[model samples]
Target: MESLVGLVVCSLLLAVQGLYSPSDDVVELNASNFNREVMQSDSLWLIEFYAPWCGHCQRLTPDWKKAATALKGVVKVGAVDADQHKSLGGQYGIRGFPTIKIFGANKNKPEDYQGGRTSQAIVEAALSGVRSLVKDRMAGKTGGSDHGWQSGGGGSGSKKDVVELTDDNFDQLVLDGEEVWLVEFFAPWCGHCKNLEPEWAAAATDIREQTKGKVRLGAVDATVHQGLSSRYGVRGFPTIKIFRKGEEPEDYSGGRSRSDIVSRALDLYSDNSPPPELLEIISEDTLKKTCEDYQLCIIAVLPHILDTGAAGRNGYLEVMMKMAEKYKKKMWGWLWTEAGAQMELESALGIGGFGYPAMAAINARKMKFALLKGSFSETGIHEFLRDLSMGRGSTATVGGGALPKIYTVQPWDGKDGELPTEDDIDLSDVELDDLERDEL
Candidate 1:
């Protein structure tokens, strides 16, 4: 009887262990249903391409489930056991365990999640995806086609800013176009084309407004317009081409995300505007003006030439500029002053005792500031900024400390010793060394 009881107890324990399940919020996906459920779905999907035996995937499971729960209706979260669904994993080029890919409107072109592995990071990414979905839907509902008539071309119908191109109108609007053009060549039956419709439409609205209608976004139905498709050598489902007034049609090889497309369009626009200026903290008045900008301001207190000279300071500035370029999406302001130039600012930020090349991010409205504790390299600064953006950085109140008194100094020209003023540089009477003698 005792032996029989022991056997029953062991069986019960095994059953309990086998019954452990993942969160119901996360949909279990496989190779058979991947196309029907993911490729054809209208909702945005955040799928985890993970392996069961991977320790990293196991660790990420909890956070993934939590994010799914939080974004329950806003976004759809799914996971595939890559070890079992090898075909599906191989289809999407998944070579790593626990790879997270965000399938926005464009299902074929998913964006990789490279942010932190924390629950907050997952939630933030999901929210961004949700925003994209809503924006795309808005474009579909309110958008109109350029064909001057209502014709349903693909999934979710036509869009407002996406001009429908044809064999007849392609030359007049695209070839002889004065403004820059971004055209998408697609087919109705193609799954990838269906996915790209929403993203393309949403990006079109933004690009149109941003470029003030100078850059037009259009689409071509490759099947309906066979002449134009054959002429462009369009063999793919969704081939994007750019057309400028005097340039050949250039292929757009960038990512299909709304942000990526918008960024690339702005680059093509090339308005020749200067990047955000790095202000010099010349006086208390300048500090007041800088702090009033509502956005987070990064303040750098660096060594004077007497300590590390201009080379060292310029090198630090270069690092700051690189970081600024990388994170231009955040719209942050950069400012700097010599170590001793702003004594009160240094004291408030505690950078004077921390040595040269110290950095701190300030929120003037909240009267709180967070100082950088790591190296001043690009990666270090990126991590710091990332933490602050995520609200993870430790901050302190101003505590009634007096504002810093700043000394007036010329802007850095990335040169050693005294910089030449504007009046010192001359262009008059300078002969062109590369001039060629031409007979009239």
Candidate 2:
């Protein structure tokens, strides 16, 4: 029996090791050799910028190592402790604790790692990046200078609004500046850069006026600024990076049109605002006004619990606030009401028939709504909204084809229920004498 128990213990230990073991093949990179090991290497590299104290990094550590072990030879997996190697982290514009970057053939322009944290997901993304690198290389040798990615290989000349950045001025103007910058890294002979010239100039002008200089747009001549080009890993003709004051730069992977750039800039510039207001749908006026004000409105019908008092309402509101913050970039409106408080709205949404913590997104103009079928927590709400943004979430006509009549209730004062002060007891007259007699 003792031998059997020992055997079971050993098996459990092995299971734990299987799940958490670090890969011996995962290269540990630091400031000292980052350039030699990653930027100049012939192999494709996926590097994770991590901090020892980050909870997410800790959770991802095992999976990252497992992915490294799986992709040992085909691709190189590496990690950098951003906390310890601050200079290297800053150079890459790593603002977050655990950012992953994919370095392909064009070692200068690494793609952001935005996939799932699972080993399988990481491996898939790495393979995809490698494939893209291979395709770009196979496209041709000197074609980048002749045809580029677009028609005109030469620029249409410089514009005034778009700041001209060179290696000498880039650091002073962008990397070390107080303002946020959206910079385009481009080769002057590249056709795509030439095409982007007009759009970029227009966006710069609009962004400057709208943001009042809080966000600026700049351009780098990759051919001239060899140092900056190599440092940023700019393998492509036109690459964009967003540099916020004192933060690591983020790759701008959004659409390249003028409107898209302006929209994304506004989103980033408004990053300091409070999470979109999570208002209570007290009356018809409030509901109508909120829906009209924002392009999309997320409404939640939460539990009404006077027994647990305002604490329950506050807890639900907290969840909404967090979700709102996570999606602040979308500029969506967040509103909530107690379950059963807005009966007409609830019926329209088909909520009370289900349960508390039900959520729906409304495009008031379209008179369409999408129900949230998943958990109402942060991740679930994020997934739902992401689908909606991508035009994937299914929508139905709002019941009644109009906004529901919402009645007002006492807004939560955000405090626990109070006990009424009792009148001074008659025991004030008799309690003292009884206690003295009993003691005697």
Candidate 3:
């Protein structure tokens, strides 16, 4: 039994190792030797960027090794463990696992390999790249220009979004600043740093536009600012770190694509923003201000105090508050009014026909509104808002194609409603005995 268990463990270990290690013909590339082994070589190269934890990368291991062995002397085949060496992978903008690139005569600008994952398909693509390189050489074109991939300052025409950081300004701009920053420490002469320049710049522009400068991107020249580099423990060509006020700097391990960086920046922005306030619609100004200030305004017409009382009404408000927190990233407005409090607003939104506890989403800019047909629970409201956000819900133009006339009203007093008392009539002066005598 002991021998059997040992054998099974050894087999499992072998299987795991096979996913990361290819055949001898395939060269293992890392941050230290990638530039020397592939970039400076005259031979055509095919490299795969992959993560060991990815199932797809493991499935492609056998075919990759076979193709490498077949093209041993003709073309160079290499693979990089992108998860382990993130700086190298970020330089190349490796967004997904099992991504392959073809490096031809123009080593700086590599073309993405879109062929099949089989050995035959990979070999054919590599051969085609080799033929194209030979033809270019025969035509006296070296194809070594750096303009193919590098763009000047985010491709935004002179207005750069990425800030330049130095030792003198790093503390003031990043550590003490009120905004979030994703800073890259890089050297000018490094090949990997050059590759990451365009991606970094583009991401900076997108993040700035999305967050309105609440989150920023910056870069520091590690070779020039040794003090800052050493402080951040920057030993690589391009190391990205996230900095927020009163927080410890953390390494950025996400993909280097523009979308990846933008996604992370937006998440940070949402975390820093407070949730939308749930306001009571007490006056015309309250209704107008909340609706016009946001892209979408969600209004809930809660049940009358006589019907739901304080506890039931509070339950409904709690649901709305949770929904508001869930979609706070959308930056929408949340408002509520008691039933019959705003008759004009209800008529314009067509809310009374559906009874109390109804909801509607209004787009003030477009003058359109969509009513919720689902229950008032959390799951129901979530589905309703999700569909509306995706443009799946039916919408109608607001009545008269404009905001309805709002009326000023007193706010809810947070108590059960009471019936008005009737005045007692003084009928004691009437003579009931005289009427009885007349009848007799």
Candidate 4:
């Protein structure tokens, strides 16, 4: 009996290890085939909603891939990048990182499990939640979809819950001046945006509850924040985005849920301080060590040029300063040390261009980083510095022009919700008489 028991134990251990193999694990879903492949899939659907900048999403990818390949005949696994399909992510109210949604014809209700970025926990989700749903279907009880999985979240659409809001004091009322301004990208004519006003107000109000006047909430007419609406890629009705202190005014273009917006804001803005570390350059010796240790260096130009005499700069700077203070350990801010002459060092770092007024982001010494170009103002610089001190400089949007490429820190980002705002638009793109006549 003792010899037989030992054999059984070894066999079970092998099965667990076998489950970690990573062959044929993940699939990409786009606008054309989402419904056919997922919503209407014959087998169960386990979709991971994530953003590339989110570190948590990065770590989860490998573990999830392992789990996905292991499931094989048991379940179908897929992924949805919220940064690409803001609309889809919005539909799901996915606020943070590594949101795993399971779809099947059962009644599991897809409960959100905040296991973060752990390999075992993610795999276990399938073994416990998904597999259990499958078992229940084998029994007599019914009502799950033919491809029924489950739905998570309680609030969908809008409720009567409202807040007092208007255009006059809107910016001050909503934006708490975390120093950087995160505003909604919206057009007045959109029904979805209009319906979101109440919720948006409620979201801003909720932010003030704990922030104690640290951050500010506001919105802009995508009809006017310029080609900015296009650069940021506002393909949908309501989009929200984060404006680094001293950065240009870019509204959200990615399709994301209200809850996601609110939750992300609370998390990102939870600590309001300007970033000062970004303004100082690293010593030649320290720079070598940093390169060796991190293998990558990401630099942000920020809004040093455009925002100087502009409207949005002051607010953005405060945020950056706060970030600087927080990440003093691994961050350096490289701006033009001399104003009149071109900064050769910054230019060499960027290849024939000055790294002025842009976010220079690098990774693992892979030598790929982005120049977040926009305007900047002096006061905006002050505010931007304030936020950086607190150590947070990130925002995400999806479902339009590709999202800003950034890295994630954790395997699972946290959660919360956001409210949508309406933009007042000038119908210059269309003719009034023609609009009334109806081309159709």
Candidate 5:
């Protein structure tokens, strides 16, 4: 009887362990300790908002554990059952099952993980995030004064990205400039302004890097530049305003965290940027120039004009154009070639056997390429690119380990294809009847 009781106890322990034990690599996060463990900590975190009953989340369990183990020392991996912790999931706007977010330098703003669901992809993305954080630190784009803002008037050499606006140049820089500006009217003596100085400066640097100077952050001394402050109706200690070229200055009403400010600035940048142009691969120069200029070139080989007439071809082009706009921030080059137009190019990219509307993403510098195996729709393309970006997709070395020779070809005429005219054959010279008689 004692032996049977012992066996029952062991079975119970095993069942409990299957649920979640201390040996589990992934930290189980909940409302009780989430803020203290993740938000307040400086370490990078990859958190998954999952539902306990979700099949997809269950399937991802082993891979998530493996990733957590691999990133043991580098990145912290955690999971929260969003179904049980509805408030926490709702806080981050988690609407789907197994949604992952990376909490890096700015814990207040966790970025959505659009990478593959596999362990390798998770590890690559986490390491990439760590590298970015380290780079920013080395560049002095982070950190703040432990004690309040320094007394050095206006701007510092480290905060060069944060432009100093004066009453004299305010109109010229903020109102007249074509770029989107986030201006802060602050008094040097105000404690709140002092506290916001470092956050604002850090945000400015990140915004400048991401937007390529299309969006700017500036500050003004409300006490010294009273006229400028009064003009914008600055009544508070540190009032922030958004200034566009022609639109009236609007109040900046977002969170004060660095991530919040940077996120808002990026949105403004995207709104200002025009949709990326889709070019046709007309010659060697066209292919070389476009591919070399961007990190990745998305090349598509659509069906021949005879197969899919002008209307069908245009429909495919529209899909590409929409995807180009969606991922315009990646700065990838988009080009399309008619089927059988560039034989060498197709051979190098291994796109011949693939029916029509085939796509391949090439990294020219690395001489690597990943072919699209899914449908040529928006969803399929988005998943393919997202996996490639996170280093999850399988890639092959470019044929000949270099770009193939591209034959110069005429551009598509946007019209249906026509068969070449054949010359008439005059066989009336009696060859058929005479040959039959001779053979008989």
Candidate 6:
């Protein structure tokens, strides 16, 4: 039994994004490869389960293709068009045009993208969501099943081939020989699906060079891959999944942009993804503005360098920070700052005059903060954060904790050659009454 358990664990590890056999390097997933394709995948998998009879899904065919091409290697990609297999579609609980679902390598429940049903948008959604899911799960957490938004897409089809992911060849799609596969699972009628059409196409074109062989992208219609979808537990549209060689899948949540989708695929260099922590970087302008206004106590510390022009400044800053923390309720609050270890030495007193290696205890706009320079140890970072949270040395802290801004863009009209109205409509030409071209 223990041996069996280990085997199961091993299997799960080997299947982050499942492998696939790309025959022509053109298109490999088809009705014939349905069952074997999905099941053999030991890693992450994004299967588009759809049906041909559904007018909406039929129209979204091209969008699916574009998604496939854009997210080739970072994940396993495949499609299971349901028309060819009626029972398969029903089993997957696909009661609509297109449905995208993702499977983690542990191979338990799959996350679903239940937004709008454009081929491009849905494919992108499924790939994006599944990647997050698989990544989170591998880290011992479930992210995809937690939260995500909806989307819209176009109601037309392009000259792209779409596949249906079915139970029969589901594993084959991932295990046949491809390194990574990112699949699109979507529904056609979803308004958001329609909106995502152009973005999907644009993504494919942009990443054409980056994805090539390392990635194999594809799609599926939830309306088709009944058993496969059911087994994976897809509950929505526009879901995404990433399949890798020897790890369980990393299914991501959120229906986002084409660039984001490409980023997931390229996280492995060349195509490359923005570093995970990059999202938390503070903008230089934002920082500068804050520094100028706040007379609050601020301390900047260097990681390695000492006994230089910056050294005195660093020590003074550190003392100042402690003093401020001690007198927080007494009108002496300080902000903390820190810099990377690689930064140059600082001044002995007053201003370090050193632009780099300045970090720890920063104050501005009533915000008392702590920063680390040069990738300080996680232990040190955590310790500082905990200290700040408790107002550690300070007797009291001003109450005010705001949630991080996690914005989402909603559905909109996406016609060819038409730009995003929100950003394009110029309020500069204000006529108010009879709108006419300004005769300037």
- Of candidates 6 and 4, the better by lDDT: 4
Q: In model 3, what is the error at residue 379, expressed in angstroms?
A: 1.3
- Could you tell me the TM-score of candidate 1? 0.45
Backbone clash total, candidate 2: 6
lDDT tens per residue, model 1, 141-252: 4222232212464444226677888888989998897778889898877887766766577667767776677788898888888899999899998999999876788999
In angstroms, how far off is 153's CA in candidate 5? 6.2
Candidate 4 off by > 4 Å:
1-23, 106-109, 145-440
Residue clash pairs of candidate 5: none
Model 5 TM: 0.56
Off by over 4 Å in 3: 1-178, 190-213, 245-248, 253-263, 413-418, 421-440
TM-score, candidate 6, is 0.26
What is the per-residue lDDT of model 3 for residues 1-440, given as tens digits with 9 covering 90 to 100? 12354345434433453344543688998766776687668999999998774678888988999999999999999998886666556556676788999988766567899999999999999988889888999999787643212233223321267788888899999999999999988887788878777557766766786678999999888888899999989989799999989999999998665546766787888888778999999887888898888878999999988899899999999999999999998789999999988888898888887787999999886677888888999999999999876545566668788888877878788787887889998768869997689899
lDDT of 6 by residue, 83-149 (tens): 4443344334454556776655433245675665554665567566666766777898632221111
Q: In order, how many clashes per candidate?
A: 2, 6, 0, 119, 0, 147
Candidate 2: stretches off by over 4 Å = 1-179, 184-196, 205-214, 219-241, 248-274, 283-285, 378-395, 408-410, 418-440
lDDT of each: 0.72, 0.75, 0.81, 0.48, 0.81, 0.44
TM-score for all models, in order of appearance: 0.45, 0.46, 0.55, 0.32, 0.56, 0.26
Judge candidate 3 against the unseen true structure and give its global Cα lDDT, from 0 to 1: 0.81
Rank by TM-score, highest first: 5, 3, 2, 1, 4, 6
Model 5 per-residue lDDT tens digits across residues 1-440: 12354345434423332223469889998766776688668899999998654568879888999999999988999998776665466456676788999988766457899999999999999999999989989998763233123355543423777888998898898888889999988888889887687668767777786778999999888888889878888999789999989999889998775656776787788777987789999899989988887778999999999999999999999999999998887778999999999988899988877689899999896677888988999999999888776545556668899999988888888888888899998778868878799999
Worst 10 residues of 3 by lDDT: 149-158
Index of the highest-TM-score prediction: 5
- The candidate with the higher TM-score, 2 or 3, is 3
